[model samples]
Target chain A: MEVIITKDLEKIYNPDTVPVHAVNGISTSFEAGEFTAIVGPSGCGKTTFLNLIGGLEAPTQGDISILGDSISTKKKSEMTDFRLHNIGFVFQAYNLIPVMSAYENVAFIMELLNRPQAEIKDRVMELLDAMGVGDKAHQRPHQLSGGQQQRVAVARALASKPKFILADEPTANLDSHATETLLDLMLKMNEKEGTTIIFSTHDIRVMNKARRLVKMDDGKIVENGKPDTA
Target chain B: MIAKLAWRNVWRNKVRSLVVIIATTLGISGALFIAALISGMMDKWVQNQIETELSDIQIHQEDFVIEEDQKFFFEKEDLERQLTAFANEIKEKAYRIKAEGLAMSAHNTYQVILLGVDPDQEPKVTNISNYIREGAYFKEPGRIKQILISQKLADELKVRMNSKVVINLSDIEGEIVGEAFKVVGIFKTSSGIFDESHVFVKNDEFAKVLKMKPGQYHELAIRTGEEVEVEAFQTELQQGLDADLMAESWIQMSPALKMTEGYMDTFNWILLSVVLTALIFGIINTMLMVVLERTREIGMLRSLGLNDRKVGLMFILETIYLSITGAIVGNILSFFLINYFGNKGIHFESWEEGFEAYGLQAVIYPILELNFYVLVTLLVFFTGLLASYFPVRKAIRLDISTAIRN
Candidate 1:
């Protein structure tokens, strides 16, 4: 089943004066359990497109539906509540709260959802173990390595059991080894847990690992298909 | 979890947090200390006035205070009868013959309030004997009348001990009378104005020249050992005394002192508000910096589905933690300092003349009521909440996407 669908989505920055079209028009859909990568060079609107799907940014003009619910018209508070239950986000900078330990970071979103504490604890620990950072649960972000922090961020994203995860340049700050390990873990989760993942990246390594690729340049998609090598 | 996060966030930058805490502590302690010092000084001033000038209660003919005329003298027998009836409630009593008059010396003449009192009873009622600055206190033995002049008045008249001064005044029948008296003592009091205006003489000697009968007196000053129950005693005396006589506590006798006591609390509140104003700005600045510095983290939290209310609460909790911690420390330190100085006293011997001019003591013991500490604690607590408002508004109003990018 299609988990996310966008129809003629457009985002314009400074539309009234010195207008820069960040995302002109994009129509796409992502099926559940798909590992999809939106690939583009800097300023090509890939991250903007991802943000729109995640409901982090409002579209200048468009319609976006996640699991058959139109999210583009939701109020800010409603959108936040929807995102809390349906959408998860991982950022390029490994945006873990510095003051929270790794375990707390994973449990934070679930806590906001008002999930049972026992269930939240079980899910958090299970996700942390799957990410191979279970032993690092009590360490703060500053005490963890870059790759470990990103793993904790992924665990945090998945803690709420969202429909899909939107990762924006998730491996941008990682070494090649850490990048491969993170990608492997995400692919394993997608296959084993039937979790849908859509990531925006300029990294060729990410594009290579993705099952489907959508390429964009200058605010418009130029190609959408599996890689020639695949 | 929110509270735990807020607690940890406050110490994220130890130096910045400590700076705010120390500033708050100093503000709280400084306000309390200044208030205590002022209260102590006022208490001392009131005490001095009561001991040296106004006794616990005073009785006079109904028109004596308003008229100050020698003709307004009441029958002293009535006062003696009341004193005998309430002897257990009374500490001491003195009958006074008061008249506005002129004191003339070899060199100068000055306007004065002539107070004639029994030397033996005046000391017990008003402690006037303790204020002798030069010579003896009515100890001279002679048929010649002896007088006690304030040192300031003595200086103005260029009169020393044993100098003869003539007091000119009206007799009870309104005839101008003059009597020559020897200045047997010089007294100095905390109030320079009182010192310069009043002269004391033996009531019998002045009464004899004024042709006043033995039972006729201008005023009766009473000392009651029950300091807190002075008003009750005054009420009882007023009920028992003749309709022509009026009994008044020291507070009623001196409206200005009573007014000063009433204004003391308002003065302390204004002072504390000024300190809290400075503290409010300091706390707002610190909390604003904390919010600004955590912009990206806040944005990330919002994107993770933490609503604006939770984020705002986090910052508010952090500010409250800092403020309450500072208030506790400040109050503890102030309590210790107040106690330390209260026992040892804060001496202003260098400003003795200045203090004495206003009837205040040279050494003051700081005193604060328990309620004052509670008020300060509440002030700091509410101040912290007020100071957090702007910064928390800024935090919750942030654009999640833009903040995250920044």
Candidate 2:
């Protein structure tokens, strides 16, 4: 089943001084369990496309329907609630809340959803174990290695059991070793839990991990196909 | 959840958090401590002038004080049976008489607090009998010539008991009259300011010396069973008395104490305003700066489904925690400070020499209490809440697109 779809999705950049087209018209769809990548360099509107699909911003002239519900019609706060209920996110900076331990960072969203303490504890532990960092759960971000921190971030993203996850260059802050560990852990979570994953990255390593890749430059998609120098 | 997130965030930026907390604590402590001091001082002043000396009720002629009109006074005819029934006095019991008059002797003359009594019924409604320190009140008609004056007054006059002195009285006709009397006793009280100025005499002797008919008095100082009944009693007396009659309670009679209460109120408001202004600026500078530095992170939270209200609440709770913690810590610190000063007392060397005519001592050492803590805590909470409002609004109103792109 198609879990994410966009129709003529668009976003304008520098709409003030000189209007720049960041994401021109595009329509696309992703199946429920596919690991997809939107690959591009800086300023190519790949992030904008991810944002519109995730319900973070409204598209100028298009629609993004996640799980068949149009995101454009949701109120700002309702959109946030929808995002929280159905979407998990990983960012380029590996944004682990600095002062929280990995366990607390993982359990944060459940807490916001006002889960029982016991349930949050159990879920945090389960996600950490699945990510192979069960022992590092109590350590804060600064105390961990870059790869360890990114693994914790992935564990946190999966904490709420969202239907899909968006990664905006999740490997951008990592070394070669950390990047491999993070990508492997995410793919493992996807395969085991059927959590669809979409990421935007320029790295060949990350692109190779995706089942499919879409290429874009200067606000337009230039190519779309399997990563078949595969 | 927001609290936990915000709390952790504050600690992440520990220096900035500390700056906000310190400024807030200083504001809370300064405003609170000053309020405690003002509140304490007003209480002390009221007790000293009200409950301690003035016995809550006084009776005087309606137009007598203003007209300086001696004729509108309480006289034998004015002492109706019902009035005397209310007097319900026992000489030397729990009540006494307070007569205002000019006392004159050949040596000198001054205002006096002449009290009249059956030295026997004096204590029934007043405290005068307990305040005396010298020769017993004269009993025999032969020694009716006897009088008690303050030692301070004695020193100025160079006279003592058995020393003959000329007494002068002004009558209802504004005519001056003179008589001779011998001092037979002395009076004193712990509150020295009153001691230095007053002389005591029997009611009949006072009336005779003043050339007035018997049974007249300037005012009656009566002690009732309870203090709360004071207002009711005042009303009852006003309704009961003949025309030109008025009754006053200690609170109404002491203008100075009322002024002190008013001053304390104004002082607390001014202090709180200054403190609140400083705290608002501090929180704004720190929180908004956090937003600027984390433009990307805010975008991150937004993308993660953190909504406007949640984002706003996170920042607001951060400020409230900072403010509340500061209030607690500051209150604890100022608790010790106020108690220390409460004991040592702030001295009023400046007021002492200058305020003598007002009969007030210069030193003002006041006590602190649990009520003061509650009052100050409420004050800090409101101020802190007000200070965080605009910052929270800005965060909640943030446009995710603009914030994320920047």
Candidate 3:
């Protein structure tokens, strides 16, 4: 089932002075349980496109439909609530709250959703153990390795059971081994939990793992198909 | 959880947070100490004036206070009879024959108010005897009429103990009369002006010199029981006095004392505001730094579904934690500091003359009521609220995409 649909989407930064077309005129849809990678060179608008889809930034012009409901018309406040319950995010920097332990960082989103304590605890530990970071659950972000931190980030994104996860350069700061480990963990979550995840990355190995690849240049998509074919 | 996060955030930059906390502690404690000091001084001033000069309440003929006229004397028997009804409230009372008179010595002359008192009864109503510095308080035997003159008046008149000072006044019949009274005691009080303008003499001698009838007095001073509310008692006592007599409390007699007592709280708040204003900027500066440094983390939180209101509330909570921690510590420190100083006393030996000029003691014991601690803490709490405004606004206004990119 199609989970997110973008119709003629566009984002223009500094529209009045020195305008930059970060994401322009892209229409696409992602299916549930799909592991997709948006691929491009530096400054080719992959992150911007992911941001637009995640509702982190409003497009200068477009209509976005999530699960058949239009989200482009939602207010900023409403959009935040929508994103909280529907879309989870992972940053390149493994942005777990520094003040929280790995377990607490994973549990943070569910807490925001006001889930029961027992449910949050079970889900957080289950996700951490699944991501292979359960032993590091009590360690703060700074005390964990980069790979371990990124694994915790992924667990946090999955904690609230969001409809989709949007990751921006999820492997950019990791070594080859950590990157492979993280990618394999994410692939397992996608297949087992049937979660749709769309991530932006230029890494060839990461792109190779995606079920589908959307290739972009400048601000528009140039290709979209099976990863090997694209 | 938000509160937990906020509290943890305060210790994130240990040195910076500690700096702000310590600054707040010193600022709040210093302001409170100064307030207590001023309160002590004022309390001493009011208490001294009441104990040594104006008793709790006084009654006089209706026109006596305004005119100081010898002819406005009231019959003492009438007030003595009415005293039986207020026996429980009345601690002691004394009658005084007050007259405007002039004192002349060989070298100088000054106008003074002559207070004629029965020495034994005067000590029961007021503490003038306790303040006698050089000579006995009406306990001497001499060949002439004896008087108690203040050291200040003696300085002006160039007289000493046992020196002859001629007092000139108008008799009740309106004729100018003069008499030589030997100065038997030289007293000094905290109030320089009071000392300079008042002298004490025997009521019998003063009445005889003024040609007044026996048992007639111009003023009747009443000392009430320590626990009695003077204002209420003044009202009750006023109602029982004869139509020709009027009763007044010390507050009515000394309006400045009443005004000072009323202004103290406002003065405390103003002092706190000045200190808090400075500390507020320090807090704002610290929170602003926290906001700027945590931009990426805050953006991450925001994008992770934390709403703007919660984010703002977290910042406010953090500021409150920082401020209240300091306030609690400061209040505890102030309690000890004030108590130590209250007992040991803060002496102002250098400013003794200046203080005595306004009827205040040279050494003051700091005092603060328990309610003041609660009120000051509330003020600091609100100050934290106020100090968080700009930082919370900045945090909420952050563009999540840009900030997360940072």
Candidate 1 chain B: 10-residue stretch with minimal lDDT:
B76-85
Chain A only, candidate 1, TM-score: 0.97
TM-score of 1: 0.89
The collision pairs in model 1 are B76-B215
User: By DockQ thresholds, what CAPRI class is model 3?
Assistant: high
When 2 and 3 are scored with TM-score, the better candidate is 3
> Model 2: per-residue lDDT, tens digit, B343-369?
887777776644434444456554557
Reference contacts recovered by each candidate, as fractions? 0.71, 0.78, 0.80
Off by over 4 Å in 1: A114-120, A191-193, A225-230, B76-95, B118-130, B133-146, B159-165, B180-185, B202-210, B222-243, B261-267
**Per-model B-chain TM-score:** 0.90, 0.75, 0.95
Candidate 2 overall Cα lDDT vs. reference? Answer: 0.74
Interface RMSD of 3: 0.6
Judging by lDDT against the true structure, name the best candidate: 3
Q: Per-residue lDDT of A1-230 in model 2, one digit per residue for the tens? A: 99988888888866888898889987888999889889989889888888788877788888888898998898987888998889998877678787789998899888878889999999999999888889988888889987788788888888889999988888988999888888888888899999999999999899998998988888777888789942
lDDT of 1 by residue, B174-270 (tens): 8988999998999988788889999998888878877888878988888897654998888988998888889999999998998998798689889
**Alpha carbon lDDT of residue B138, candidate 1?**
90
In order of lDDT, best first, we have: 3, 1, 2
Q: What share of the true interface contacts does candidate 2 keep?
A: 0.78
Q: Specify the poorest-scoring 10-residue window by lDDT in model 2 chain B.
A: B88-97
lDDT score of residue B255 within candidate 3: 96
TM-score list, all predictions: 0.89, 0.86, 0.96
